[model samples]
Target: MMSNPEKTDLKNLTLPMLERFLQGRGKERFRATQIFKWIYQHDAGSFGEMTNISKDLRTELAETARISKLEPEAVEQGSDGTRKYLFSLGDGNAVESVLIPIEGRNTVCISSQAGCAMGCEFCLTGTFKLVRNLTTAEIVNQIMAIRCDVRAAGEEIRNIVLMGMGEPLHNLDNVIPAIQIMIDGNGLQLSNRRVTVSTCGLVPEMERLGRELPNVNLAVSLNATTDELRDRIMPVNRKYPLKELLRACREFPLPGRRKVTFEYVMMGGINDSLEDAKRLLRLTSDIPGKINLIPFNEHEGCGFRAPTQAAIDAFHTFLIDRNVTVITRDSRGADISAACGQLKGNLENRKEII
Candidate 1:
């Protein structure tokens, strides 16, 4: 049997790109909006379902472009209502997206690459080695897929955190356009504040992201207070360094009440000391940001343990007493291994089963 020709993915195109594509085809400019609403609002899966569009245009679109929707191969829901979705890619590899529902808030944690290259000592995903960067479609489709699931269950995804498998800033080209589609009022329509891009402190790309999506929230995983400790755990620090990274955080463009979130993962006997807390307070003292103290989640072969409750409490109290804005963001989806820094591209195992 002959394979069909690859159809262009209209869903991958940002509004401006879609408009340009349609305009090049000698079509009206307003069609982009119509098609966007059909795809996003009406949940039009195929061109035939776009009834408001001209028949000829719909036929042309069917022949030339298509929308690629993600179908989760497997889904595991945590007792805490966090669902981890495994999506198969065209390549034999797979990626994971998470749906975390907290009381009234629905958040989707999406990945940017197949595996990670940053090699953070405590993260499970770093063990797989970097495979490939996901395209804009792959990134956006995660939200679209999760959004559909949320709507089906009578809830809607309100927040998106790019804190899944890989470092987003490392894949800036695809990520930027994906961000455009995410915040586009005519498309996903997510507020910039609701969409957050978490990075392992890629200073230059972080700067570029702020310039492009200034309103989008930026979260930095600053797990260690000392450069020496950080360099050991997060190898990215060896290049960016504490001095340079903090400088970037301080000078990062923030309008109104927006503040950069500094994520500090507390490792027992490592970076959770009273002095460590003091160092962290001083390090971010000049920057306009809040702190999220996350206790490490022990994964098999990762050899890290979550800090004791007393230790964790002490760290949180230290920051609060000093009048520093901080919170302890406990891990969710621990039972399903979808918690922060725990996604390990289990697709290899899925491929074996297939």
Candidate 2:
């Protein structure tokens, strides 16, 4: 459905917020739960599709509200079955989400903002810089829109990672509520373990995420082993240095069998040395988290090359031999530019040249 700025986007509201809206309209609070179930669980696109609700109420709701869904401006599929979607945000901006199907599980990597402000030296999105933070409806609609496609393909989105276009913690105001709806049993019904929020070391907001949504898995993008290196790569490190970031990580409350995940992108000739691995072991020894070494996904003009297989294997072996938990993540959708911000950047460049 088309966006209507004059009407309330019901997807923007959490359960309580929706309940209050209904109550203020002289309707029963239970109606909010019903509407939520229809919207989230049943995939109701229009208020009229919510047949269980009274026709009169549905008419009233439709006038004041709209159930907005993002229709992808374009979709690209990789040979490995990973699909990247470009969704227009209706204000001359767009964001992307990647759907990865691996070994019977589907994971959707969702964006929290239209473009990134993090300015990581290796990232493509950083070149474009920040456009704006996505609203709650925008974030939730990524899941809703993709889930429809997943269902059609006879699969389901089993996991979600906030590791796409933007830093999740930077937009916690909208991200947290979108997360709350995701884990809400009556809504998305995803277990807290299934939803992962990846941050580029936003320490203070990371602490708030732990305190507020302690059960959801947290993944920190700890790409560098030293502050000198990290400060050069991830700009956020300059503000919340390694010592303070690790302190907050150590304090983060993880639930049973859930350790924080440290995602280290191995950049060839950059942060992929055995020395860096040894330093990484020392850095993460105390924190209850495992290392996920991602060989950097190379892109045009980024100036950073993907780590050699030898470098990746060496890093994994060192961490494993030292009794540190670690795994090498397979780079998915490379043919489709599935790496964060690649597709969006390419589209924008094409438009410029056109």
Tens digits of per-residue lDDT for model 1, 1-354: 001228777767888889999999999989998898787777678889988898999999988888877778788888988999988876787889899999869999999999999999998888887999988888988898888889988988899999999999999899999988888888888988899899999999989988887888889999998889889999999999999999888877877888889998888888888889989999999888999998888888877778889889998999999898998986889888888898866855765222
lDDT of 2 by residue, 1-354 (tens): 346789999999999999999999999999999999999999898998998899999999999999889987778888999988888777778788899998879999999987788888888877778888999999999998999899998978899998888889989999999999999877898888999998888888999999999999999889998999999998999999999999988998999878989999999999999999989988889888999888888887888888889889988999999998898988788888886446453337534211
* Model 2 alpha-carbon drift over 4 Å, by segment: 340-347, 350-354
Candidate 2 residue pairs that clash: none
How do all models score by TM-score? 0.96, 0.96
Clashing pairs in 1: none
Q: Tell me the whole-model lDDT of each prediction, alpha carbons only.
A: 0.87, 0.87
Worst 10 residues of 2 by lDDT: 345-354
Error of 1 at 317 (Å): 0.3
Worst 10 residues of 1 by lDDT: 1-10
Question: Residue 164 in model 1: shift from native, Å?
Answer: 0.7
